[model samples]
Target chain A: MVSLSDVPLTKDRFQTARAAHLWLVLLLVSVSVTSLAVGASGTSLWGAFAKILSGQSLSQMEKVVLWDIRAPRLLLGISVGAALAVAGAVMQGLFRNPLADPGLVGVSAGAGLGAISAIVLGSTLPIGIVALAGNALIPVAAFFGGWLSTIVLYRVATRGGRTSVATMLLAGIALGALAGALSGILVYIADDRQLRDLTFWGLGSLAGATWGKVAVAAPIILLSILGAFTLGRGLNGLALGEVTAHHIGIPVQRMKNLSILVVAAATGAAVAVSGGIGFIGIVVPHLLRLWTGPDHRTLLINAALLGASLLLLADVISRVIIAPAELPIGIVTAVLGAPVFLWILLRRRGMVDL
Target chain B: MLIANDITVQLGHRTILSNVNFNAQPGTVTAIVGPNGSGKTTLLRALSGDVDYSGQVLLNGCDTRQLKSWELAAERAVLPQASTLAFPFTVIEVVRIGLQSGTSGETDSVAMQALNLVGLPHYANRFFQELSGGEQQRVQLARVLAQVWDPVLDGTPRWLLLDEPVASLDIGHQLQIMDIARNFAHAGGGVITVMHDLNLTALYADSVAVLAHGSVLAHDSPMQVMTDAILSKAYECSVKVNTPPPSGFTYLLPHSAGLATVSQDSL
Candidate 1:
């Protein structure tokens, strides 16, 4: 109901913002399509987009490339990107720590470990069985893993239903490290092909994305993100800090639990699909914070959009930079993101926090 | 009326407040004064039902513990010593928090009125954390005022608990805050505040409770509890009660005494 990042686009005309946001969303979509169409094959960007939308029959190779190759991959990138970003925004609001991301409760490493176990075991089974086991079972395991960490962290930090940001951060760091170690152990046990698969997967790419894969990740991402949007009001209440939140009857514990679940499910799903892409959650919210203030309504939704755009743009660059030989989107994001972080740091030099 | 009964609080196995009992009529400004770690804040927390306590608190003849959180919230508001806002809420948004205790009915209007009462309506769109400390205190007061100013609960008034809210304010804002507290009490609200300024306590308190070592040392009218002996012993310093010319109203002024005995009767 209340969003901590609810900076109404116009301090006056709040309702007008949806139209603008839609326009921006559409503009980004066009950009995404253009990036995909103008690939190494040198297809005309508008002709490819027109052909894709108009139901014009493609040649066998074109059909395979467009529908099979680019389409599902783009959707997966967009959806997972949005999920990771929104999850990040919510995490920052809940913890009151700007540096915190969706993976704070070991979600990333947990997901990575779950995915790795699926890969190692999948090698022993049929390819379909392994793909099913890895894609379906891994996210569920990752979800529970994230949920367990959140509960433990909540208990360690909370007294009388009020959670401490500092304690949660410390707990998150410890848990994340532990999960990372387990991921390492899992990686160490893989065979040659398994190791190759894990290596490239660990680096994170959209190459494996099919519509079926998008379908695997989409429901969890969509539902959790929508749920988080509903918490815009509650998140704003949370930003007031716990005592006042309780004073205003926010049901602080319940809100924290709900936020954790949403964060876990959303981040878990993203990690299950995207591998351990770091800092989308951290950077998106930080940038949005500067633009939208601390209100979550604006912050949450903007983070989702900006993250989609950022990931789409990142994926496009990853695809085009190496031509047919693509770089992982994860590597590209970190390469691009670190410089922005540095710029913010330098601009605010001597100021305590950016 | 607001009543704090048999409230006992322990922290890390040591009793911070033990069996504290007190009551104040509606429309009265009650001041709680004590030395450091005397459990004044703990008592306020207990009364506000912000933490666990051994006993019950009653507001307007209803048990605070038994009332649903939303039910209890409509009848009282507490402003702690420090409220941290991590979000960049505008002044209006900060005050709007007080309105959530009840229906959102006419709250924007009332919030504006509360801000206007604090002489801050012009800053409605300004960021809350950007304001000066005094201004922030005023905005916080405005928010609490909106909470207690309920139309449906008009017949029976609510309570206000302020925990040293004026500590960071300057002399002008301090007096302004004291005036606001006095006004709120005079308007049939039960008001309790912990204050260190003896002069302020004398100025606004209808009844004063002095706590020492987590116990009530004295509870009575200002003149009764604020004698030279109690003042000197409470602060462990020599003090002179000053009554300035023209008004003849008394104020507390600390003094240094070296190996000499003095009497109030001499003054």
Candidate 2:
């Protein structure tokens, strides 16, 4: 019985992916525990557990702090981080370049535009339409915005199935600048409360995590992340180019469509809830690829785990850095990640295929 | 048998290939030869169903378009002229990508065997991006070979569609790759290759399809097709076809139009 497992290459790759899954799962679990325990509120998960074990009813403060505040934040963080990282891996695979991160490619900015518009221009909408859309408006608008930008960028940067890296980067910059300008105009007109909310949201923080936001973002992010995992084999084949991927039995067009949708949905959901959290998308995938070679099957899953853990760790830092005056999580990630991105670019100067 | 009937391809306002017909029986090495832009690769792309064309390709009595991608994959494998990896995958990993959708049902050592066939088994652990152009070409060939490991499965012969498989190779590797194609045909599979080397084509190809100006000039045995007149006209140069006495192998020498008679006499 000559099974595929007998092949050395298959065996090595299987072992690597399995090992990555094991380690990354452990990392995620530990990070989740740490994130639950450490906060400026000083209501530790250990304290609550100790009281529960000693058979005492929990106080209102602990319950509110732990369940109401930290739990939803943790879940929301995991979903956003995983969504961003997996979306990054998928976009890189689709563009066939390491630098094709959602944040860098203007998809995040476009989604941010959708979200900002929903917030600033939301009250002006027709009463019937606003009532019908209700809370789903922002995420839905963000999804459409992300989808539109991705399509435009793809059309502008790719011709005859070949994507030009220079063109893609240039188009991304142009799109980002345009979206930023529009966002500036909206920011200028916002009232005081809305302005405060807009400013914090634009900086990207997890302070507003609520069960309602979790309910909205979690299912979409989960479904899209799982969907992205199914594209592992197709993306691996696509690394050889679209025609060759088709020749090797991958439905290239279908995979491309699914990838774009998956990236758009995940990024849109994450952006709607977490605001413009950048670098998790680009940095997580790049670090994971360096650790384990770029097999999308393992890379997507590993990126999710590592991305979640790293974001939670960053969230912990954001909570303590100013101690009760939380620096936005986005600042922490950029401070840590931008240097790594530059180092990778410098180390791989001529090898980037651009 | 692989047959392409009335295959025509148009890109924008220009016709790349026009009403071309070609066929290859199993157990033979067929070659497509032409000038730089004579649509050799385009014809192969049409046959492989990699491009849209206004014609039909039948593989072993079944229309290629009618078959699903996996079904077509089970019947034939294609080797592109060159391939670039998007990420740094190991040689073995790149080769393993071939096994994902293959009809060769989970064979134990097929990937390794294919690598060995391409003389790259030892290079399995090396990153594919670090290899030279010729080595990378062979690794891709190994991948293609691994896809259709059993050339004949379930009494139906599979096919190898190679587009300039040895274009980046040295002379030794070129001969090595040609031999692999020859062996595949000898083992009851079909081999259709687009070749740039006329002498190598004459030495190895059982049948030659000469293409020029988006049309087939001739599809015949090498002995019948490698004439000086056909060669010169197809290439628009003064090409002399010679068969040396001892080995009975065909060769060609290309020269300027004015030097044709003088060069022939000297030869």
**What's every prediction's RMSD, in angstroms?**
4.8, 3.5
Model 2 CA deviation exceeding 4 Å by range:
A1-14, A126-137, A151-174, A352-354, B101-108, B255-259, B263-267
Evaluated with lDDT, which candidate comes out highest? 2
lDDT of 1 at A300: 81
Per residue, candidate 1 scores C-alpha lDDT tens digits across B1-267 of: 888888888887899989888888878899999888888898888888777888878888998878766676688888888877775667887887656622255877888788877778778778787898778988988888788875226589778889997888888878888898888888778899998888888888999998888878888988788877786677667766666789856697555474224554465
What is the per-residue lDDT of model 2 for residues B66-112, given as tens digits with 9 covering 90 to 100? 99887888889999987888888888778888676422436426877
Assess each prediction's global lDDT (C-alpha) against the native: 0.76, 0.88
Q: Candidate 2 at A194: error in angstroms?
A: 2.8
Q: Which stretches of candidate 1 lie over 4 Å from their true place?
A: A1-20, A31-63, A121-137, A352-354, B67-72, B90-92, B101-109, B121-127, B149-152, B229-248, B264-267
Interface RMSD of 1: 8.2
Root-mean-square deviation of Cα positions for candidate 1 versus the true structure, in angstroms: 4.8
> What DockQ do you compute for every candidate structure?
0.35, 0.51
- Clashing pairs for predicted structure model 2, backbone only: none
